[model samples]
Target: MDNISRRGLLTGVGALLAAGSLGVSTASARSLALPASKRFKMSATTNEFFRHKPLWGPRVMQSFAFDTPNNRLFAGQLRSETPENSGDLTLSQLDFSGNVLGHMYLTGFGHAVSIGAEAVGSTSYIWTETDADTTNGRGRQITRFPWQNGKTLTSASVTKWKPVSGASVYTPAVDQRFGRLGVRHARSDGMYINVYSLAAARTGDFSTVLASFKQPALTAGIDFQGWALYGSYCYFWEGEAYPGEPDETKATSKLWCYDINAGVLVDSFLTLAGKSLTYREPEGMAVYGSTDGTARLYFGFASGEPGDRRANLFYRNTLV
Candidate 1:
């Protein structure tokens, strides 16, 4: 297939793209079928990235989303090692196997707490949680961008980005088929999952809260990091803080599953023990598969050492 640039895609579509917003139906709650722990075995780890770079690591790879239509994976890199107020956001474009293809550096967006991507025809839209600073009680500032493909995002593209009306949600996972945005919010009681209509929310209208429920097991202080919604299931990371460990990498990581439509806890298990990877501080997660029934899950690690050649370990496992 020839590469079709986003600009060419929009130009070719004309008024066909004008068809707007779809109505959202409420998801019914039901019992979730848990997956067996033995199903996920340790898989291969990819090459290391951002090794010991002061400007990057400590918390380099934070969040990622799969652009299935484009056959690309987009990852959010938080520049936590940099000075405060100096900018701490970057987006990396990658292949299915986790190879960096391009990078977009976003300045003044604060820390990228979460990210969701949507591809319209060929144009790509990125919705992200930049920071936690509240304006009018919106817990975090959520921004959306229509990226024009380039080696790097132009200043014009950055300027054209707009804000989405959501507050306090840290994780944004896009279900393009249903046009819904599955997000995770922290509450005093527990971790809550809410699905909003993407079509309605884009127009600054949020009448559709597709699904809303709390998962008490995601207890307070158990950091809910990476998240991805696939089919009827929502997969997320629980990088709960470890005892006597200041570095997040030392903390163990686990994967939790929820049936979004059924509104029930399906499965929870620790990450597979990879040969070269320890699955520590797993942050960003993404699901990629082909139509022929082949599927794999990808995960990004937060910390490790360049000396051990395991500084930036990212893993992929067959879904079977």
Candidate 2:
């Protein structure tokens, strides 16, 4: 974090304090700039199997994470259009430019809600919610995969347990620099963020909660779509999509970039309104940047309508 962003964060905190309480409002502080014209697009077809389907399933690229050291993008896909049929999960590997390199089909899981990817040298770790259903049974767990030659997926023994039930768990973000895992989800009141030590979480030791805060920006019943943590900032995303019907005019883009280190929001803005038509429901996020303060943010949107079920990835080059 630079002096400029640090000051911005402090100023935002002071404003919230003076205002008495944090409410559902935009950060009246700095605003993020429009994404650069240099953009890339990939369709559900990139995974090959999903290309010919008339209506792409509900969870097409539901979660996203960037492996900084390996320069690979990991995307988690739920093949079922509805929760009742939620069982099949696929993990796709791609490059920064939206090219699918290879993919692996993940099985032996029940209702995978979200996925977080982290890479340390040749070993890769993925955190996700498993055995969770629309009715009951949900738990957070991590898996280890070592890829030096052939592709293989193995499960790790989760020795600890701290269960959060019945809430829609969005994507989790791993902070490699700090060895922390950040997770967010929706409840009856608002959204809650949980930051856990990566070292402890890997061993299923989720005892000490580093930072737990409520995001008043979301009201009760509002859906938490996607989020990511990079450097000292955390980017949150959601959209306004009319149920069943595809209306680009009614669809909206809700995005907020917060500085977790300073405990304040840095930027808030909305885009992609009546523009792409297919860019609705922002469900996944990934940030590729450094601590010195420069990043390219990527968002994955899943389509609901049949005609618009094509490519669904968007990017913004600037941080704020």
- lDDT per residue for candidate 1 within 86-142, as digits (tens), equals 434657776644455666766545444457888777878887754433221112445
Cα deviation of 296, candidate 1, in Å: 3.6
lDDT of each: 0.49, 0.49
TM-score of each: 0.64, 0.65
The list of candidate 2 runs beyond 4 A from truth reads 1-59, 80-85, 108-113, 134-171, 185-190, 219-222, 242-251, 261-266, 303-308
